[model samples]
Target: MEDTDFIVNYVKSKLITINLEILIAKDGEDGVRKGQIERPNLIIADLMLPKMDGFEVCQQINSNPKTKDTRIIIMSTRNSKENVLRCYKLGIDDYLIKPFGLDDFEQRITRLLYS
Candidate 1:
């Protein structure tokens, strides 16, 4: 779901303490495919992904019956009003701008996973 290794590693580092299984998808298509199969409780995706964008990724996963309940958090550097509003309209649970802090990230994850 995440495009860069740094963010992925950061996510892993943060999520490790929570004991959640992590899955990596190389691209948007891969993310959708894996989500259909794994149906994880939550998904965190980057906006400017290769092969497909975050918006499409959210659409496909949200539309799929198997993964419809999966909580999604969209991450992007561009926190435009349009982008954030679009993500919300697509039924994404939350959105995060890039360079977010560990505490904020953890809080959001906990909220989505537990709420």
Candidate 2:
């Protein structure tokens, strides 16, 4: 989940009946830590995280054998080609721009999970 409480709660509410167990990370470091321990099938992260940015979080997760295969979806307000390309290069499965609609996010998640 993202660092902001509002975003996290909003996402959780939108996915209320999705049958997926959701976990929240306090920041990038916690995200990486939880990824290693929980080994979730998917991860949704924000670009501007405290302590470490999303890029570093991606590197940590990707490099770690325990969580390297986890699907990642990065959300950011940057909307820059370079950032998106960088995330792809880091093996993220999807990238979402900030202010994205919940329906669109759901569609992306569905595609990522079922495709």
Q: Whose TM-score is greatest here?
A: 1
| TM-scores, all models, native as reference | 0.97, 0.95
Clashing pairs in 1: none
What is the overall TM-score of model 1 with all chains considered together? 0.97
**Cα lDDT of model 2 by residue, 8-113, tens digit:** 9888877775777888999999999999999998889999999889999999999999999999999988899999999999989999998899999899988988
| Count of clashes, each model | 0, 0
Model 1 per-residue lDDT tens digits across residues 1-115: 8889999999889888878899999999999999999999998999999999999999999899999999999999989999999999988999999899988999999988886
In model 2, what lDDT does residue 89 have? 95
